[model samples]
Target chain A: AQTVTQSQPEMSVQEAETVTLSCTYDTSESDYYLFWYKQPPSRQMILVIRQEAYKQQNATENRFSVNFQKAAKSFSLKISDSQLGDAAMYFCAYNANNAGNMLTFGGGTRLMVKP
Target chain B: DVKVTQSSRYLVKRTGEKVFLECVQDMDHENMFWYRQDPGLGLRLIYFSYDVKMKEKGDIPEGYSVSREKKERFSLILESASTNQTSMYLCASRYPGPYNEQFFGPGTRLTVL
Candidate 1:
């Protein structure tokens, strides 16, 4: 069983600043996938970014990037130039490289972007 | 664009009442999932279906049942609604593949009083 942990329950950042959301997971598998999902208040959940364990280079998408440390079992999301739209509940998820495997998610971090 | 839609955005039911939450996906995804979201608990998987008439128990399958007679639709059922079952229910679908991302619905907030 894999478990993802997000130690921070809530995080806040000033608009145009940068913020990092921490995540850690326990998995014995070498090849897997890590993902960040954002869900605004009463809105649909959307994928922000994803990182493959085999890829050494961190994944970057626009202002959202991930710090994926396979050895430490840590995968964190960094949001640069945060805007009000970035204010949402962020979740870290782990997926094993196997068919029909469901995603294991963390407790989630509520991000607040202040103006 | 993949779109997953739930039957309702909000629902209210009384204890012991039979409740059914429907989910449909526009894409012909072979895999469908049902999850419940609660504050401080992120989302917990309740059930999943790989194909039509094929169902699998997820992390928290107790107090819930699912029906999938069609490939594009998955239904979550509460035989006897309880207060503990009141929560936001989410539906998701994804193509049959290891690296494919799961597309989520807007979610249905159910209240059992």
Candidate 2:
């Protein structure tokens, strides 16, 4: 079984600043995928960014990027130029290649953007 | 765009009542999933269906049953709703390939009193 952990329960970032949310996972499989999802008050889950375990280079999507360290079993999400609209609950998820598309999610980190 | 729709956004039921939560996907995805979200618990998978009439038990399947008679529709049923079953229910769908992204619905918040 794979488990994802987000140590931080809540985080706050000033407007136009940068923030990093930490995530770690335990998995024995060599092939897997990591993702960060954002859920706003609307209760809609949205994909932020994704990283492939085999890729050495980190994944970047506009202002959202991931620092993926496969050896350390760490995948952290970094948000730059954060805005008020960025406030949401962020979840880190792990899925193995053979898991049949079932996602294992972390406890989640609630992000607050301060003006 | 892929869209996953749940039948209701909010529902209230009494304990011991039979509850049905419906989910539909327009993407014709082969895989559909039902999950419950709670504070500090993240999202726990309740059930999943890989194909029409094919169901699988996920991490938490107790007190929950699912039906997938049609490819695009998957239903989650609570034979006897309990107060512990009150939570935000989410429906998701994904393609049956490696590293495919799962599309999620808006979610249904159920309250069992």
In angstroms and one decimal each, the interface RMSD of every candidate reads: 1.5, 1.2
Worst 10 residues of 2 chain A by lDDT: A95-104
Please, what are the lDDT tens digits per residue for candidate 1 over residues A28-92? 99988899999998899999999989999999999999999999999999999999999999999
lDDT tens digits, residue span B10-59, model 2: 99999999999999999999999999999988999999999999999999
In order, what DockQ does each candidate have?
0.69, 0.69
Clashing pairs in 2: none
In model 1, the runs with Cα more than 4 Å from the true position are none
State candidate 2's TM-score.
0.98
Tens-place lDDT digits, model 1, residues B1-113: 99999999999999999999999998999999999999888899999999999999999999999999998899999999999999999999998765778899999999999
What ranges in model 2 sit over 4 Å off? none
